[model samples]
Target: MRKWFGQSLRLGLAPDGLALVRTSIWPHERARLLAQARFKENNVEAALREAERMLADHEREGWALRVVLSDELVRLWQVAPPPGAARMADLEAACALRYRALFGASPAGWQVRADWSATRPFLASAVPQALLAQLQQAAAGSGFRLVEVAPQFVAALNQHRSMRRPGAWFGVVHGGVLSVAAFDGALLAAVRTAPIPEGADRDWLEGHVAREALRVGLGRPERLQVCGPAPKAWASSAGRLKFACTLFEDELDPLWPDSARLAMTGRAP
Candidate 1:
């Protein structure tokens, strides 16, 4: 089980769109879609309009909102544990500093969110504060309170809680980017996101996977669970490395919204 972040409703923000869903934890209840809309990436006006439209369609008063942002807008990193940090603020500062050093960019207007539950605690995301503020304002105006903002990859992983196997690798290929996450039992071992080169072939995909696994010190995974569109020859290629590949056909759909809903309810998709 995961710690409660306090929200039963979710709004998924993608580089190209947005989606909203309400979830129920009751045995006999089911999750429902409230509203969804698409917009061009980096178009602030279009995003705002879609957000307004989604909020206007639902009676969201008193409903908690969890926003899962696209990986394109957030950066995830795995860093060493902070030394002698005694408070959350101190830890956050250290994380920010590390992020700045890694990316060579100012963290002044970036919101850092970390997860300290693993043996090698990591920063889950660093998102632009301005973007977050816009989302918050939109939710507030809609009579809903924004409770949490998370990365899309993290949300997608949360949806596979039941399928998580120790010493396994999981990948999601979406929006021309591939996100690979390694897990050992309930602890996240390593995570990486890389862009897929245009017209990449099966060999290139296999090589990329091998390199990522090496970077994470996993050597090779016995199993690789994958979602989203992938080359048809990927399974056979991975089999050469002794990895039993499993693809979740259902997860191949637009994932942002489904991941958001799963993140809120901790339910398998």
Candidate 2:
């Protein structure tokens, strides 16, 4: 059996601390939540000290700690590592500290927009692509499916479009997050996902969307739409990205279950 735990943080280069949202996944009722929580509760300093202890006692329990860091942490990760030596496990541990400090939990899977500065490295690295492919495989192997990478803003736009509301304009949804901004033909108060995948950056997309949001006079977006996998992680993005509405987990999951199902039957969530 496979066990998963995840958390997200909305961090930045600026003085303002990063924002975060986090959660863990288990075999529904199979795994012991308390055990998972105990393992996750370890701090970097504490984690290092308890490493052997954890490995000896809980390693066999089955658990994976996944974290979604904001842009700031990504920067730290690059320069934070000591020049001499750093283990992969150490890097992951530091990442855990950064993520935990911001969001108070660890994120298993993450979805970030194209604009965030932190996302740049991830986009360039093999990690995200691997994660994407791995996610597909995991879903297939586990019989789960991953849905569209639609943002909350796009969900609102779709909803608005269906209602036949006026003042509707162009919309884009990436990674289950939303960015709905009213286009007044003069300015756009657009909002988008911020707590993107660590190292994943939307170089050109960030400026492009923000400018468009301003140009269109993006006003307060309607409702926050929740659809597809990692909806909770999407919610964590909202705290930092500042979306107009929030999506309900139950609603989104039923409507758009994990797309991994396409690869495997009866294995989707």
Candidate 3:
């Protein structure tokens, strides 16, 4: 028989800190915050070293790790497969070429990953290879397996995609940055991110959406869906882009930064 489901751990990497969530997948999906740490210099290498120490005493021999990286750590863009493209290589080559054109740098230093497609446009992401190697080393040193690494924006979309409707915009906010995946009807058109400035309110959200819509040259959506740490005052949605925001991991999520500070050195609070 094929082994389909097993243990899994989620490592959330942000600009300032990191969060580790372990999930039991065999019986049912139950997640518990394992350990979270803040980087001394807000660097992935520093964060990874801290993470290794946190998991030094934990025993997870057969568990797999899923890393969710913040958008700032990655260069994200849309890739359209060239006409007459048929093989997987064609799609990958297209992504690589697009990456070079957009970032003006070779992808050799970055690990390019994407939802490969030949018929429609797909999102592509490139992460620093050195950061990836550190993440892999941390997992191996902790006696866990590093299975997958993905951008938090993409991961959020995959999780709540069924809730999204045609032409609706989706956003994920984390670490004071908002990552948007704009869709023209059912097809994703553009991906962009901007930092959420301090003291901004509901009107700021609307203005930002309007600017992004114009930037992408797409009509404004009639609906929007947002997930992550959103301002509470924006709950009363009477603005141009008003929508109910959903916070995943409602209880533990709000305390994300604090969780990282408090749950250090293998201590859970």
Compute each candidate's TM-score over C-alphas: 0.74, 0.25, 0.83
Candidate with more favorable, higher lDDT: 1 or 2: 1
Root-mean-square deviation (CA) per prediction: 5.5, 16.2, 5.1
lDDT of each: 0.67, 0.30, 0.72
Candidate 3 per-residue lDDT over residues 207-267, each given as its tens digit: 8888999999998776667767677655544543444433333434445573232222111
- The digit string of per-residue lDDT tens for model 1 on 1-269 reads 13322336777777566667776556455556767766544665576578767876774576777787777778887665666767766666667677888799867788876675323566467788888888888888878888888777776666775776666688877667778886655456678788988888656766786788778776667677876665555665523655666665652234444334333432344
Worst lDDT run of 10 residues, candidate 3, spans: 260-269
Q: Which pairs of residues clash in candidate 1, taking residues 3 or more apart in a chain or in different chains?
A: none
Model 3, residue 95: what's the lDDT?
88
Residue 242 in candidate 3, Cα distance off native in Å: 7.2
lDDT by residue for model 2 over 32-82, one digit each (tens)?
Answer: 211111123323333222322322333222233222221222221111332
> Whole-model lDDT for model 2 versus the true structure?
0.30
What is the C-alpha local distance difference test score of candidate 3?
Answer: 0.72
**Which scores better on TM-score, 1 or 2?**
1
